[model samples]
Target: MSGPRIDPSLYRERDVVPIRRALLSVSDKTGLLELGRALADAGVEIVSTGSTAAQLLEAGVPVTEVAAVTGFPESLDGRVKTLHPSVHGGLLADLRLEDHERQLDDLGIRPFELAIVNLYPFAQTVAAGAPAGEVIEQIDIGGPAMVRAAAKNHANVAIVVSPDGYGEIRDALASGGTTLEQRRRLAAAAFAHTAAYDRQVADWMAGETGQADRVLRVEATLSAPLRYGENSHQRAALYTFAEGRGIAQAEQLSGKEMSYNNYVDADAAVRAAYDFERPAVAIIKHANPCGIAVASAKAVDPIASAHIRAHECDPVSAFGGVIAANRTVTLGMAEQVADVFTEVLVAPDFEDDALAVLRRKKNLRILRLPADYRREIREFRQISGGVLLQTADSFDQGVNSAQSDSSAWRLVSGEEVDAATRADLEFAWRACRAVKSNAILLADAGASVGVGMGQVNRVDSCHLAVNRAGARAQGAVAASDAFFPFADGLDVLLQAGVRAVVQPGGSVRDDEVIEAARRAGVPMYFTGERHFYH
Candidate 1:
């Protein structure tokens, strides 16, 4: 059967609605008493459910229980208290329609002018490592129902989903009542709140069930609006999720606002800095590391020495670049870098004297990250149509110098490496992982002498590395991001005094490459896995 057609003239928007009755149910009791008192002073009736009614009564505010309005007893552990016709009918009534007004009067239902609700702590419970049964019990059903119903009738009802908006709600009611525009804004906020809650629950359940190919639904709130994107003409903003701490969450104590290029280079710098256990520093230009160095065992001031070595690698390119340090920034290191024009500096901490010294540079950004910051985070990239998701490149963390048994490497030429040479080789391999392919790195004495990256051919990269290193290339170890397609690449490194090499041996001409290293008397090892970052 079809219902009677409604006239278009009957539907009209209400500019402001006076509060006659309201439904207030919340798990978070913040600002409840204040809102309740404001409504009471305005001569509005307050209806609540469960312990909320008890709290309002204790606060000397008049309240009507939800069960009393529905004419039914609370059942199913208080879950069935607000899922009745009286509540929905009041919330969904069309205030401008004559037929709707007659139906409400005949059913003895009073329309609700406001709905204040906040859902249960399902996300918090899951974060605390609760069991499945306990986490499932925290999901609220009737709360979302009433919230959606009130949001649908936003023309007549005002909705508030967060405690931060209580002041706005109070001022709106005090200045007469809520306007239509205010109600519409509140409605939009209510929908976003529910959507984020549901996404957290879905992601948790998918992980528990071992669903590998689950759909990725991200809900991020705006953190900041940048001055511009990669270019001056493009617009951009920053958004953050509810989980994990990274460069986005770092504390910026002093400096100007961050630009889009600053964030990109800062993230890449930190990813390389966090891979080493010893005190180290990485100087990044654009998105690639121009210089990388760790402290030597016998240095008096290891952190300062590392900074000097890194800065000396390519002083021209290091100007106005982002720098990352695994240890604290000290006065000595600050003095060493005072002459260069650095745009940003990130470290675990900064000494009191060092901070004061660096503050002289008015435009330098200084960030203090958490001590235990790591790179074991999920990565996402946006393309033309959709997003690509994968785990970050963190296998470098498990690489160790002394424990050669864990590596899938086999010595195929020259002789086995000593302890010190093996250590430098491990450092070189981890540093190469952060550079863009085709990548080649040379290191000696726990510091990178030269690095060649973002080149098209492997032979050109070797030439660049050798040219940068000059005399320092002698007796230095080398690491390649992938296997050499031809033996000439290995021969070039060997001729430049590269005594040892580490790379993923998987090319069809692996035998030929091994023979070339054998003739040059250079030891070579294969890691079985590649670490190309393009």
Candidate 2:
């Protein structure tokens, strides 16, 4: 395919253009007073609309209202305020065209050299759980129109769409006006801002109307640059969505900057910690759960016990891993972790004594997740050519039912699970879901004994789990994200002395697998729901 031919004459290259007049209208009003003062100091005439005009007037800045400039009043509840030909003609006129210049003069429309606008908070309204009517009303039509017109005529007009852009615009105007390059950059930013706004409205409406094909769109802002990606050779950065919660929202208390792998592993660890109601801890390495444990009724110190037990699951792998706890970190718990070389620790809060001890390790990263933080509603994955979107794996979904003795799970073979074993099986299943595909998780009491993740075959996962557990596998319970393909995989766990098993049984050889468990006198339960994290 041939590339589109470029027309050199359509483009004008210049060093700078002086600004004589500007139109300012904004919903956020951020930096408006400062920007107005700066424009006035530069001898630039300012025109504004509605509350913006009133605000500038109160601030003692001379300004003209949109209605005064257009000779038309706002109608349809202020929707038609800036849609006049006078406003658009000034914005669209081409300086190079004599006919366009003459037309502006013939209509007596004052050309605006600059436009400052930011659309209404439509996405914020939706996120606040506003009613559909209120959300629809928040969508700004005139703002986007003005932004597009100003952006399209970048050769003559400059556009400002964000409060962060105010400094550069003020600097340019104060230093003998803006350059062609600066105007082009600002125009591109304006277009992108409007485009994202439109996408948010479309997605919100599609969701309301039950549209079948929901095109995944994410408006994520860059949070920070990471030292490296999965490998030192690759490049990566972090992006935050909505109010920028989750991993990006976590406040770093003390330590070296978090790397790409640290964020990945920390995210997984925190998710696992959130699954349990009691005092729990999860240790993760390479985006896989190496250890997980919940406190039992008999434990005197729940937090410390949970941390110690979790660290005991795979002590070697836990050396440089991330640790996440649901409860606050106390001095005693900090003392336990202080013995090992941990990379990161995340929790709701940390006591002063705990911080004093943990901060001693200068390179250990510590993060505190906000108390009101909620998981995102949708999950996204990038594929080869496109993207995949689905509802997030919520804690109340299929997995949580088994914890409450819901009928969604059925005992398939051998014998009914006792109360203690059932609790372990549920805990194992929760941890298993956090692991990668082809996962097998083993648990005893309230702690994960072993975990096998990202294996190609079910049998290999079983073997990996058994090897990691060692003697701990004897009489331990296990959870599988999916059904075993054949009797061979079940036989491996049975021979390893896994007393009880939980799986989502929907394989072609389900009968054979059940029979193998029955013959081995191993109890098995079917959750009727698969959790494949790939």
Judged by lDDT, which candidate is best?
Answer: 2
Tens-place lDDT per residue, model 1, 318-371, is 999999998999999888777799999999899998899888888999998865
Q: What's the lDDT for residue 90 in model 2? A: 89
List where candidate 2 sits over 4 angstroms from the true fold: 1-20, 37-43, 58-60, 93-107, 124-139, 167-176, 179-181, 204-214, 298-301, 397-407, 519-521
lDDT of each: 0.87, 0.88
State the lDDT at 28 in candidate 2: 91
Model 1 vs. true fold: TM: 0.91
Could you tally the backbone clashes for each prediction? Answer: 0, 0
Q: Residue 398 error for model 2, in Å?
A: 8.3
| Model 2 lDDT per residue over 129-176, tens place | 999999989999999999999999888899999999999988888788
